[model samples]
Target: MEGKTCCVTGHRDLPQKEINHVKAALRREIDSAVADGFTRFMSGFADGVDQYFAEIVLEKKKTNPALELIAVIPYQKRLDSLMAKGRTYEMLEACADVVVMQEKCHPSVYSHRNRYMVEHSDRVIAVYDGREKGGTVRAIRFAHQFRKELREIPVGLILDKNRTNLGQNRI
Candidate 1:
């Protein structure tokens, strides 16, 4: 429930072809954060990359029992909104060490959730496609404004020379 916390944010509709590569990059970023003494990971419990990030945190806890997974649920009906995104809603709720529910749900509930996470976290690990809009873009911008250490994985250009395949996935 304490120590350095990293919040996760990303798009819901990630391209299928980049799933593996993006996940790899996210895992690496998370591992590096752990090495830097991040003991807790926070997720919005949304679809796509948020779910993936939460899964990685849970998996990492198997080896590092001290690590914690926290779900920052925005409003009471947040799960209902997230339910369409596979079993992430149930999984995160069941596995999270701490689940913080907001007072109410509003039209801008997700924005509130993102703000809460960014405000509390010391760092942010976001999978962004650089589309110039959407919640992912907003979260990344918010993180920068809050001066949180950000590790952004460009899932859009999953095949770009500089970012793709980690150390080496050359053609």
Candidate 2:
């Protein structure tokens, strides 16, 4: 679990339709990784795609005893704010075997969190829409800088193919 580490990064908002597609892709990638003896998965546990990835990894961890989910928490206060919204955060937190809580919660907390994940991981499972200059892009870039193997679930692939939402809506 320590050596075979992968991280998840993605936008905070995404359409439900696109989410389902990403979920399927994620399941395939994660399960394949498991078969290859890659057991550790780190997630920021942010809203939308991050949470989805965490949940899926947790589910896999249930039957696969070797699988471990590590929550790279940026700040406890921000996590508390998200937890106040509902039980999803609690569920994710419960599943994580290791919670890496960062000490500082500054304006650049998320960027710092992304750096931590990228630096710690051997690979990255990125879910990006490719429509914005967002945190997801920055994290992917950082992973690239470290030469981590990236497996992307590009939401823009689906959105752009349909060309329905244009750029008005983003995930």
Candidate 3:
């Protein structure tokens, strides 16, 4: 599925009010990607957007078992450091493949993982709020540099439907 793979990147902490909208957007993108003949979805397994992306991909996999969820972990220690280890572990257990980018944490480990994902993926789906910084921005820049197809979920756009009480809950 080299040519059919898509990787996701997003913020680790989303605004509490926009969580539901981000999730809905992610679901829509994943469905659209699947419909377009994409089968393998890659995730960084980070807290907010990455976990949400992985969750939605797994839900899609229920109906289409051919869909594969790949975890591109930045470092071996990342799992241990995450606050939502239980949820992350569950996602890891369900993933079709997991690639630990680094055995130890370093300043560039996460960037390396992001580069790896962008390099291997034919398309990139990003949940970005138009922020000029952070890993999501770097990933998006890499996607441009590599000339990958990019579909973005506009986090900065505040829709009335997106304003809800869905606080900081994990799916």
Candidate 4:
């Protein structure tokens, strides 16, 4: 359709509660996207939030057949790190259109994957802790540089700095 396509990115390691928060935010984003006539989703298939996004899209596809879920994998060997590659394979086989960046694995493949996602998407939904480095930060930077609309769920913003419990108490 002539609507937006969104890509999902997030931290690789997160606490369970934060993961749930990210999922909740994603659900809201998906709902908003659907309302805005966006029916396509792209995910990089990373361990944490990416996988969650894909799974949610797959679930939504059951009722909304018009939705398209595309898995943009960094490399083929990324499957090795997956706890259950078969599940991912089956999901991709059943719901997603797979795009592999490189036939062989490389340390830099994830960057390629992030670029591909950003290039193909009109918007980015990021669950970021606002780290200065890492793939999520890099992807956000790319989105910013490309002038793509960014929907960021800042999970770590509050915990980033420890201040006084009361108003303006300094040691």
Candidate 5:
């Protein structure tokens, strides 16, 4: 297998079960990348799957000194709303090479950050719930538009079984 840079993207509001599944999928993808001699990883540093991927890379780096984890932050200080930002920052501080999309926060900086990750990566690993909007959807669409190889993990199983109306309810 040939080495290649792997990028990760996913939904931010994933259920706990779905989050675990997505994390497992990302670990597999990262392991595959390593088997293929790829030691570099890039993550958007979002709350859910992005954080999971970054953590996995950080763990791998402890055992494999050659592996590199890059945190492609969408904007500086855009993480204020995320409860996991502190932990993500700690992980970034430990093992990641940080790349800020903008020196300051902007409304559309995340979109630009996603584009940058897709443009620079050899492939994308995405966890989506088949939504037509949101940052995850946009990132997947960007990957498709750019003709990048995508490994998708759909998280529809996370939705409540009793809930039929998705519009008024949260997944």
Candidate 6:
């Protein structure tokens, strides 16, 4: 899985209007990765982009048995929170492996999980706005340091599309 794995990182709270566009981009990127021989996809199991990645991978797994979804959970508390979401719980149930990085929550647990994912993955698919400084940014930086192949779906692209649509509506 070391050389054939792809990990995903992104913002947890996405603009509701951009969900479809983001999903489309994710599907395209995932398909491209499959074409490039990536079989295992890992997700941090966060709310927005991570959930979308897990759901897409699970859906693809139904048609392609070779594809695997690995859930890299940061801590026990975070896992509990995710389990409360029925969709995420179902996703977890369908995962090939669930790795709990920490038993208790720590300041560095999320970063640790991000590092672990990048370390094990050959590529990274990031849904970033290119401005916010958070876990997503840190994960992308790790990808660069580790020299992993990166495919970014910019949030700003979706925002620009919305603006264009708004402008056209006024015409």
What C-alpha RMSD separates each model from the true structure?
Answer: 4.1, 5.1, 6.6, 3.2, 5.8, 3.5
**Worst 10 contiguous positions by lDDT, candidate 2:** 92-101
Q: Mind sharing the TM-score for model 5?
A: 0.82
Q: Please give, for residues 1-171, the per-residue lDDT of candidate 3 as tens digits.
A: 553999999998888987998999999888889888899999998889998999999988888899999999898778666425777778788899888888899999989999999999988999887677789999999999999999988785433324433442432
Off by over 4 Å in 3: 81-84, 157-171
Per-residue lDDT, model 3, residue 7, is 92
Off by over 4 Å in 1: 80-86, 93-104, 157-171
Instruction: List, residue by residue over 31-68, the lDDT tens digit for candidate 1.
Output: 99999999888888776888888888888888888888
Clashes of each: 0, 0, 0, 0, 0, 0
TM-score of each: 0.82, 0.83, 0.87, 0.86, 0.82, 0.89
Candidate closest to the true structure, highest lDDT: 6
| lDDT by residue (tens digit), candidate 5, 1-171 | 134788888887887667677778888888888887777789887777888898898888889988888878777675444325677558877754778789787778889999999988878888878778788888888899999999887677434432455755774
Measure candidate 6: CA RMSD.
3.5
Q: Write the per-residue lDDT of candidate 2 for residues 1-171, one digit (tens) a residue.
A: 465988899888887667788889889989877877788888888888888888888888778767788877788776677667666656656654545466657888888889989998888988888855878999989988999889888786555765766555665
Q: How does candidate 6 score on lDDT? A: 0.92
Q: Identify the superior model by lDDT, candidate 1 or candidate 6.
A: 6
Supply the TM-score for candidate 3.
0.87
In candidate 5, how many Å is residue 80 off? 7.7
lDDT for position 109 in model 5: 88
2 against 4, candidate with superior lDDT: 4
Q: Which residues of candidate 5, in runs, are more than 4 Å off?
A: 1-3, 79-86, 157-171
* Shift in Å, residue 62, candidate 3: 1.3
